[model samples]
Target: MGFSTTHLIIFLVIIIVIFGTKKLRNIGSDLGGAVKGFKDGMKDGTDRAADASAAPAQQVGTAGTAAKETIDVEAKTKV
Candidate 1:
């Protein structure tokens, strides 16, 4: 069966006794910070992926123009 409210309270009390309130508080804060950092890192990675994909499209657009410009330069240099 699932844990009732009383069982949950008893479990929490045992945990607090094993690890004092101060240590538990610090542990809780550290866990929260880790979760926050992980979320931020995931978001940053997604943004970088989006930027990386966009960059290739722009490079492709420029590549076509660059090839045309290079041919003109070569022709002029020969003349």
Candidate 2:
């Protein structure tokens, strides 16, 4: 089963005893930074989708040709 409230309380108590208050505070800040980074990434992805929707549609053949060129470049670089 997933962690219930009681389980979470017990886990927090153990973490406090093991890590102490100062280390726990640093961990909280680090976790906050990680969450902020994830939010920023999601925002960037959403902006890209919005920009794509606003732009004109490109020809399917044009995209296919560009993709082939990119693959050729990659293949050359690898070798």
Candidate 3:
């Protein structure tokens, strides 16, 4: 059977008695910090991906323009 509220309370009390409040508090804060770091890393990765996508578009645009100019020059020379 699943743990009832009374069972959960008793379990929590036993854990507190064993670890004490200070240790439990430290553990909770460490867990929170880990979660925060994970979120920040994900945001940084998403920003980098956005920047990388934008750079390629600009490079392709310039490359295309240069190719067009070269083709025009070749056509003029052929005349």
RMSD of 1: 4.5
| Top model number, TM-score | 3
CA RMSD, predictions in order: 4.5, 10.8, 6.7
* Model 3 agreement with the true structure over 1-79: per-residue lDDT tens digits: 9999999999999999999999999999999999999999999999999999899888987997888667455547643
Q: Which ten residues in a row have the lowest lDDT in candidate 2?
A: 70-79
Candidate 3: regions farther than 4 A off: 57-79
lDDT of each: 0.93, 0.86, 0.93
- TM for every model, in the order presented, reads 0.68, 0.51, 0.70
Best of the two (2, 3) by TM-score: 3
Encode model 1's per-residue lDDT on 34-75: one tens digit a residue. 999999999999999999989988998899889876755555
Model 1 misplaced stretches (Cα beyond 4 Å):
60-79
Judged by whole-model lDDT over C-alpha atoms, candidate 2 comes out at 0.86
| TM-score for candidate 1, residues paired by index | 0.68
